[model samples]
Target: MAKRILVVEDNDLNRKLFCDVLKSQGYVVEPVGDGRVALESARSFVPDLIIMDIQLPNISGLDLIEAAKLDPALRPIPVLAVTAYAGKGDEERIRQAGAEGYLAKPVSIGPFMAAVKGLLAQVGAVAG
Candidate 1:
């Protein structure tokens, strides 16, 4: 089966773009708009990897990552944070929150896919 990827992004265009790219690369993409819904979907989808946006409405991505790390069901899933709020020391914060990797927006297709594949290889053991 294709590797499952949960895309948690708030922007419609970014969400669609990520999903399209991952789908075209043969991943099973589950897209969600907010952190709360992401949590719910993560349980049902049981995705191997997650691409999360930091700035979210209901719950922040950091909070979501922390929560996921505490939950045994979602703990093994690797989270890659894709955010536009990148600043000095931001990557450290993201990593501290439990995300394995960080990608800044506007994301480039090649590098983004590379990062995803690299992280997947480490955690999900599947290539992009």
Candidate 2:
């Protein structure tokens, strides 16, 4: 089966871009526009990986990541944080918040897919 990916992004353009990219790569993509729906979708959709935007409405992606990590059922799923906040220590903060990886905003399709594939491969290895 194709791996499932949940994309939580508030911006319509970004969300659509990500969804299209992942879909082209044969991933089952579910895009949510707000953090509140993100949480619900994560629970129900059970994506193998999450690509989260930090500046989301309702709840910030960082907060959502933290919450997901704290939840035993959700903690194992890998999260790749995509943020425009490329400030100092931003990467570290994202990792500390339970994201397996971080990508700066305006991510290209190649790097985005590479990161997603890497995470999914890691998960596959662990599962196997």
Top candidate on TM-score is 2
Query: Cα RMSDs of all predictions?
Result: 2.2, 0.7
CA displacement after TM-score superposition, residue 33 of candidate 1 (Å) = 1.0
**For every model shown, what is its TM-score relative to the native structure?**
0.94, 0.97
Local lDDT at 101 for model 2: 87
Candidate 2, residues 64-125: lDDT per residue as tens digits? 99999998878999999999989999999989999998999879888888899999999999
Model 1: pairs clashing at backbone N, Cα or C within 3 Å: none
lDDT of each: 0.91, 0.91
Q: Which portions of model 2 miss their true places by more than 4 Å?
A: none
Task: Provide the lowest-lDDT 10-residue window in model 2.
Answer: 51-60
Cα error, residue 12 of model 2, in Å, equals: 0.4
What is the Cα-based lDDT of residue 4 in candidate 2?
98
